[model samples]
Target: MIAPMALARPSPQELWEMDRQHLLHPWTNFGPFEREGALVITRGEGCHLWDAEGRRYFDAVGGMWCTNVGLGRREMAAAMAEQAERLAFSNTFVDVTNDPSARLAARLADLAPGDLNRVHFTTGGSTAVDTAVRMVWYWQSCMGRPEKTDIVARDHSYHGATYLSQSVGKRPGDRVAEFRYKETGIHHLSAPNPYRRPEGMSEAQFCDALVAEFEALIVQVGADRIGGFIAEPIQASGGVIVPPQGYLRRMWEICQRHDILFIADEVVTAFGRLGHWFASEAEFGVVPDMITCAKGLTSGYVPLGAVIFSDRIWQAMAANGERWFTSGFTYSGHPVSCAVGLKNLEIIEREGLLENAARVGDYFLERLQALEALPLVGQVRGRRLMVCVENVADKATKAPLPDGVNESKRISDAAEAMGMMVRPLGHLNVMSPALTITEADVDFVAETLERAIRQVTDELVREGHRIG
Candidate 1:
């Protein structure tokens, strides 16, 4: 056994100095990081995390929506160590394969909906999405329709950071750096955000309008030139924007009639985050042609991602004879990562985490919904364990907080002081705790958020901001 080592640990000030001088984090402001440095989390166990200074805080965001099984599981650590000792590395190029990878693929095929039985492994969610888009283009080429290469994605949808994946993604904040493919044949459709829908329109009508807009785009762009329509069942990073009821099903129907492939980006929704292994068909009644998943596959114990596709695409490639489908990563089916993923899935099933998420998620969301009664809260929405709280200056108009308010960040900061952590996205605070969270944990989260928002609201009022 690889037991824990009792090495001398750095003090909080030393750690902060090291981080400030070295680490360059992702999606960081730089200005603030230069002044404040990183948070320097030291340890995590179950649903809580401890910083370098030994301060404990509730992990409400689940480690960027990936830690479905929480942290510090000895079984998961043991599985990883065992796999590394046995067979740490192997390339899945051509016919080469490993036992864990093959077994995990078969298991994922069984859990996936419809004929999505084929699996292509990658290092993480970005690469998984990149593989899915590449496969779509390759499938079109194999069908002898090379012109069908354009992809349709929705505004505010976050796919990944790879070139092809980023090209298809349409997040405004991600694009501010002006780094993107100049002409990637990617198109955007309106987001089906019910809270921002046209005034006086019912949810059903809003759904219809969004579908009609998609249809119009297809007609204008010509379905013959479009290869795929990629979407997240619930847009997590984009403020947890859940589409109107029946919206995903209707979109799938249109894609079916137009011969356009549908790719469900379930990176944040898969592996018990939404009370299921995959949420596409189970929650939304849509079996996409391809489903990209990662994050909770190993419950964030290790880095792993995969693209699960229907047999139709596999059969099409098989029909193309000896011509190779030549695209893969160096660590495609990494033995250690695959072993950890399999063990993670085993833990989730054995512990009844899925059932717990379903039962407790209802109470969680119900508690969050009650926060809408607060003056600064415009909306609280989510499904299962994934939820978002949108801040607004006026509930009557659904207007966002003032230009420089940064309400979400203020609330998050306050919540951290109150012993909880929540993700701040623009004017929204997002939360997706581990599947192991209980009703008692839910109560802590709700109470902490209420206090945080109330404190921020008071600050805004004193600062001369005209907030609700």
Candidate 2:
């Protein structure tokens, strides 16, 4: 047989040109894309990434808050390869099953809190959330309550990118592209952002007000018209806005009273991100009716997402004799992805990553808290590894930096130049480093971020922004 043609390894310039020509990146600013092009990251290993030119940078964003096991794991690779060779693609449809998928479902059930045992695997977070929405509608329809079809979502909460999922999402910028489903039965409430609460209101008062608002909405909208409420334990994409104390629990109580299904979108907070397999009940003391999770499920090693629902949903379906859910994906529970998930879970357990996240994440936040002393830092807030540093023009007034200042972008650019990566969300810089991160890694991140913030402060002063 003739030897296989050798694979071509494109040079850095060639790679960059190819990306600029063909790749359409997500959440991209086209103007900047046309001007600067994308950074071609070639490889990653243990909380760090290397660009095409072989420059190393600390992955403070944890590969978009997913790479909990870090990167470049030989075991993860081996598991994927082995599963692919054994039984890579199998349709997990009616009368069909795969070993990895079944096993993982059981494992997740064991790990999940309460009766969140039924698992519906999807290709990624968006689809998982889409599935949850579909199920809510389906369940309501099946129960002969089609009128109770509206979904309640919080402002600035990110569920996913799918049409239905994005319809439920309320990020103002995310809606600028348009084409969202109009007449979609979705409602929104104010985000439980304590920092932005009305002046003279304590955090406890803010929490009470938010819960009251939720209850009032339910009453005003008529609970008979509401089917589900979806929220993130921590609004990850919305500048890591941590809800006030008792917010989630109180919301769940209202949902219970209103006969509404509560869906905790744990896409970013699950699977060791918050030092737990699931953060809904573990971190927030709320056992939601459903939890849509992805990201750290497979530690960014492969694409996999799941919706873990309570037995009430399962029982409803079971009680409906001969009625099929009639929803699934061609690659739902792909054996390779499931196998990788199993191995990822195994790695997390064996390596004690959960405990590591808890310990190191606390230290990391403590170190980042020091940055609040900086003039531009309005607040530093987070739990475990997920954190955000909000930039402000006036700290005492808590006024946001001028949009033209591009404060977060400037800080992210400065950090990148100094060998670190952080996500720039408007006026905030968000970070969710790998669970494998160490105290030393936290030190590096803190130092780099401090330097970046200081540099940006100087630039802002030079630009005459009059930051205080």
Candidate 3:
């Protein structure tokens, strides 16, 4: 029999005080953070995480929608170390390039769908999204269509946290007020939420209604004034909202017809999260003019992102001027990050994580759907590894619970106590476990979620909230 080994570490309270004193977390409401500090995750292995006190918990969100290959990868570390020993960094500016950057770019282009043949690297998802918006501006200006200035996004969309990307994404709270340049022309459409679909409509009809909504908005704003239509195949932070079938294709057709660039923000869905390298074309049957990806590109080992472009967009971009793009970061194509990305992709391919995601995603969704039997579960939905369990106030009317409802958070906390991690967003508990998660792992998540949901449901019932 093997005995557990103990290692000395700082006390949890000490670490918590240090984190609260120095670290400023993103998308956080710091009043509570000031009082409670943060969850100090010490390390991760496979689909599980260990906190500072060595409490094990399944990472149901894959470390904020990255970590497709899971955690504690020795080979990935070795790849980064090898690259650091050889060539750690280089400037991709001035036509300079490194082996890993060049090869990884080509590898991404080949894996991406359609004529998305060009790659522009960035530091991470936020930068990638901002870069895509800039590229759209550049593309339109090069084509002598400067009037196309407005970017069209949807409700519940999360592009990034950069200034431009914050304007591109929907609200998290009052964070938008801090920006000096107010969002003027960014248009937002209704979120494609099927669970809250209009009364008495089939899934296909709801899709048509949503498309019509977009068309009417375009007409209201005038197609000539629009620059691009940015969308996520699956809205991650937006309660894991999945649109009706054929919605993506129709939206693409409308964008093409209006001469507007189609930007697929696959920062969350790309790299096997949706059972493919890119879900826009592979799963949705439409090709985007541009796609911004990060997150799983290097599986969280290193920060990296890429702006993939179609031939049409690239041709317009190259014909603009000879004076270089005057964009990109010092670490845009850092050889070390790219080297890790190259090895990461090779690992994903060699281990067949994509295939695993496809096969297990169905099982995963099925497991979530089983929660519909619980009165507290309003709806269960998702694709592949990404799934959600929505707690409702009323199932007959599909009414949402009151704002500031804390049951979701409590349930998530309970799940963590049961050795599982989940993301709670507006009464929705979201899960996007690693692609490397097995069927047994799926069962573990499903069973733990059921227990947590029931515990919360019983409490809510006793409180007479009627949440179902």
Of 1 and 3, the candidate ranking higher by lDDT = 1
> Please, what is the TM-score per model?
0.97, 0.98, 0.95
Off by over 4 Å in 3: 1-9, 171-181, 320-323
Listed per model in order, the count of residue pairs whose N, CA or C atoms clash below 3 Å is: 0, 0, 0
Model 2 misses residue 185 by how many Å?
A: 1.3
Q: Model 2: per-residue lDDT, tens digit, 1-468?
A: 854435767889989998899988888789999899999999999989999999999999999889999899999999999999999799999889999999999999999999888999998999999999889988877777889989999998888898888888887578874474644578999998988999999999999999999888887889999999999999999878889988999899988988799999999999998899899888889999899999999999999999999898888876847788788899899999999999999999999999999999999999999999999999999898999999999998999876877989989999999999999998889999999999999999999999999999999899888887
Clashing pairs in 1: none
| lDDT score, candidate 1, position 45 | 98
Report the Cα lDDT for candidate 1: 0.92
Provide the global lDDT of candidate 2 against the true structure.
0.91
On the 0 to 100 scale, the lDDT of residue 264 in model 1 is: 98
Candidate 3 or 2, higher lDDT:
2
